[model samples]
Target: MTTMTPPVTPPVTALNALGFDRPAADTRVVVAMSGGVDSSVVAAMLAREGFDVIGVTLQLYDHGAALGRKGACCAGRDIHDARAVAARMGFPHYVLDYESRFRESVIDDFADQYLAGATPVPCVRCNQRVKFRDLLATARELGADCLATGHYVRRIIGARGPELHQAADPARDQSYFLFATTPEQLGYLRFPLGGVATKAETRAMAAGFGLDVADKPDSQDICFVPQGGYAAVIEKLRPGAAEPGEIVHLDGRVLGAHRGVIHYTVGQRRGLNLGGGDPLHVLRLEPESRRVIVGPRAALGVARLRVAEVNWLGDGAFADAPPGGWRAQARVRSTRPPAPARVLPEGADTA
Candidate 1:
């Protein structure tokens, strides 16, 4: 009788950057392409790594209106550029019509928020309501393992599960705009460029990979708004948004009149045009009364603030958190570094 030798198995490969314990060829990734270099480089890098990369871009607004609109992402020109990148990478590309959804979820809310006398970050709302929520669903329906974007934020595995951390690049860290990212969305999202040390490196990667968007400029804040005029767009969206309003001092004295509350924001100190000896800053806006309250810089300083609509990404259950609360670093603006913070949980939703 002949002795038969058993066949040996191949060595197993460890999990990938995306946390998938499978071969890149066997895994599928849906990339949200904004027709910008960062996202283009991501798709190219994954394609070069042998992963099944699918490029999807959203038609966020009217194609006719978006024509010739530069320095804006998700515009018609951006959509065309994204298609070119997909073609260059030799992958199947898709363009989803999200005009109606964008108008409802982002544009309308932006106007409403400004009309309500509040400073709104529309990028956060777009990510929360549109990309991470709605677009992520489309990725799942396509049988993708995960959805990825070019945001400069890290998603690392902590003691509990996936945790959101600031990107290594401090100058390019976009954590403030992403504070609304829910714990569930954190699990399925990947940020390849978060580990990058600089935006230059991203551009370098694009150049090395021969992507056409290597020299493309980054998108400005409020991509839908042209010329960075927040008030102009709001006025165009909602007629009479810039109605005349009384500019009143903190001491109940009328200083002057303003075009609209939308033209002013809290902490603003310039363009008062009051011909003043003492400088005045915008303290608050009362849309109901259509009045702009002006005061000194000292009035803008506040030690305590109650933040509604909180998003918790802690490792443990929020309710199980310590009574004294979690000690963490927090920032009020993206331009400033995080300061010491005590997070006292009042309920399951807020702290």
Candidate 2:
């Protein structure tokens, strides 16, 4: 006569049965509300779940002064809307002036990388330096346990370690822009809209909660460059960053001239004024010679890529691995699926 144990209930069900006991009820969380629908909903949801939510919006840059544009993310109107939403949700909100930091970390780096002829991803840098580093530190100083954002990606806590996965909504997956996020940071970060919530659903939730950003249009341009162009912004920031350079063919013959090395990137086909018989593509950018290399499209395909500042998720994926070894899914850019690659530890700085 053995006494059989009852089946264990799931945590979600147990939590609900216990009268919606919020996992973070007494925990203080700093929500990075970007005056967008998704972030606004995140704040509201956390508040509704009985957690102490504090909203902080980083005033990254002046859209009007920088790009002579308005009505984009991080502008005056967006800040007002975010503050209004925080008020409506009955939470404390603060706008942190991060203009200088943003310029140094994101804008300056972007311009410098472009001038150096490497395709720069500013959003990744922003997430790494601004949001996670600066904002996360602020949250800690404010006695908050964690930082939350409106990223459309999922962080799954696995037996081995935490892993970042694509969002339930495939269309809005932001994993690419978040590749720079470290594993330690993931432990302190939360994405409330990770699971299968479409943009329409998020907007509806905002409307239901009476958020001021319910009808706000999604920001399509870079938050700093509201006018939807980067060339002008770079020119203004670093006057000589866009010096005119020569466009050359694969055979080292000068084809024509280009505005600057900053104007081109890998896989770019347009604006190359080389009137040759065959269509030309930007094969490579030689910053040393200040020359734009144009050639046929077949030169772009490479089986290997070197990603600097590599951050691994799992435990010891390459602990005993040799240099130029160890296979893993390498995501070159965000939004694209991670492709199979042999990741080798190049060096401390060039991983």
Candidate 1, 93-122: lDDT as tens digits: 899998899899999999999999998888
Clashing pairs in 1: none
What Cα-based lDDT does every candidate model obtain?
0.88, 0.82
Q: Please give the lDDT score at residue 46 for candidate 2.
A: 84
What global local distance difference test value does model 2 have? 0.82
Best by the TM-score measure = 1
Lowest-scoring 10 consecutive residues by lDDT in candidate 1? Answer: 62-71
Best by lDDT: 1
After TM-score superposition, the amount by which residue 322's alpha carbon in candidate 2 deviates from its true location, in angstroms, is 7.8
